[model samples]
Target: MAAVDDQTPRAQLTASPDGRVTIPAPLRRAAGIEPGRRLVAYVEDGRVVLEEWEHLLRRVQRRVIAATSGHSGSAADALIADRRAEAAHEDVSADATLAGRGAHGPDPA
Candidate 1:
């Protein structure tokens, strides 16, 4: 076991042949994993990995909410509205340029 730093507690552990590994208390606390909590495991790059349930989805939702919470509408609705407005603006500009070319028949030069 090794402590990476004094302030930020971290440790390294090895897995046993029986597939049992001990999780350090500080690391468990930081990861929000508690006793009796359920976890998901999957194989990646020939290595077995374990992660908390709903971990990925929850993390993405947290980031989205944090980024858009201050907007006028709800986070999800605001994102949709902003995207629609951008698309509409692009369409209007495109139509205006097309109309201008048709009316003026290109540059005088």
Candidate 2:
């Protein structure tokens, strides 16, 4: 449970006849929303949370940093490359083993 902090930003929204709400320009700008941009919405803590995909990714990234204690630096790319190389090597080795076995499969004598 989080304590109530009145410092939270608030805004009023109005829905049209078809239940479509028009987000005020100021709020939309603050949230990085642009014209014709798509928003992702979900229910969290009994409230609707909406934001652009990039913004949501940034929020999750921030949490990851805190959880990892700043250890999630730029090593992801290198790690992925290393794993792919290992998989490719295993594939080549398997193919070579299969070819070698076929040559000595059986002596037809």
Candidate 3:
């Protein structure tokens, strides 16, 4: 366990057999944890981390911005361009096939 600094928030909690750990009112107030608010908990660097829903959302947004920062356009634009190329290829193939069999389309049976 890492040594706790005086400025870091501290609380002693006990978990019940059912695995529920209730946050004390003072700590909850200090942490801005509302009664009905959602939280995301995960282990990081061997320590348990509890993050509020909004905090996680902001963190993910930052990560996405960092990842796509160098791109000139959004990923959706690139996907649309690829789809258009595929559609054009299919159209050319269909035209070639139609030309081979005449405009009447494939012969019956």
Candidate 4:
């Protein structure tokens, strides 16, 4: 086991020739990674990052399914629809107010 200091950036250890790298207990505990935990590895800025793979994939798949089924619309679409309805209501109210303006006499103090 490698000794990691407080300032150590999660020691970058190499896998054995057999393609196996033991995860440091401290790092695993901090990341909530444990035995039977699935992980995804990717390189960013020349360094490899390991993340909880199954959880991320499940979240992405759920979003994709929702979008494909049209059960969930994007935030922008919902906002635009709401704004359009509000504008339509405002226009109707303005038209009504203008048409009734002459019927109401000058504002009585």
Candidate 5:
């Protein structure tokens, strides 16, 4: 809290002996961090940052959508199609292996 950086918002906070810090209610409300929300903590540039997991996911989703929008297909759809193709390849390979084994006895070992 303590205005860790001028670029970030300031909040008054306290850390207990067990190394747990409580984010004040006002700060939480301002940041839209609600109760029962999941979070991730990380250190960057020698600063600790706590962020809601949903927020991170949304930001990444936006980035992905923006990155893929120029393409003629949806990212999720493309991913599903790719996975299906991979599975089909695996099925073909397995069938070929089984057929080969049936057509020819085990190789001399």
Candidate 6:
């Protein structure tokens, strides 16, 4: 018996002893939820939010785009840049090791 805005679609749902709740057909249709549709549920701002998997995916994608909007290039580009940095570090380490060694091998302790 939670209070919701009158303008928003509201339904009284009763959970079974096993904690299963049924979403009414009207609400389901309004939310574009069909039978066997995948759903993601979580609490947002102290309220429970149930979203379709597809909708959640799109929301996340939008967030990612907004976050990286200032940055140039795509995910693949970022990954390539990271890999290049790693390779350069490895090369520098190898060069240092080689410089520390004598022509034959490591110097006697």
What local lDDT does model 2 show for residue 34?
A: 83
Model 5 stretches with alpha carbons more than 4 Å out: 1-9, 72-77, 80-109
State model 5's lDDT: 0.61
Q: What lDDT tens digits, residue by residue, belong to model 5 across residues 1-109?
A: 3545555556777766555578877678767888766665656789777666656556555655665556677778779655655565565455444544543344445
After superposition, the stretches of candidate 4 with alpha carbons farther than 4 Å from their true spots are 1-9, 58-109
What TM-score, computed on C-alpha atoms, does each candidate reach? 0.38, 0.40, 0.57, 0.41, 0.47, 0.55
Find the candidate with the highest TM-score and give its number: 3
Native-to-model Cα distance after best TM-score fit, residue 32 in candidate 2, in Å: 1.7
Candidate 3 accuracy as lDDT: 0.63
Ranking by TM-score: 3, 6, 5, 4, 2, 1
lDDT per model, in order?
A: 0.61, 0.58, 0.63, 0.60, 0.61, 0.63
**Tens digits of lDDT, candidate 3, 1-109:** 6786787667889976655578788778877888767666656999666677556656655655565556677789667555655565565455444544444334455
The per-prediction CA RMSD against the true structure, in angstroms, equals 21.3, 19.9, 20.8, 25.7, 17.9, 20.3
Which residues of candidate 1, in runs, are more than 4 Å off? 1-7, 44-48, 56-109
Pairs with backbone N, CA or C atoms under 3 Å apart (clashes), candidate 5: none
Instruction: Report how far off residue 20 is in candidate 3 (Å).
Output: 1.3
lDDT tens digits by residue: candidate 4, 30-109: 77887866555656789666756556455555554455455366888767655655565565455445534532245455
Q: Which ranges in model 2 have alpha carbons more than 4 Å from their true place? A: 1-10, 57-109
- The lDDT, on a scale of 0 to 1, for candidate 6 is 0.63
Q: Is candidate 1 or candidate 3 better by TM-score?
A: 3
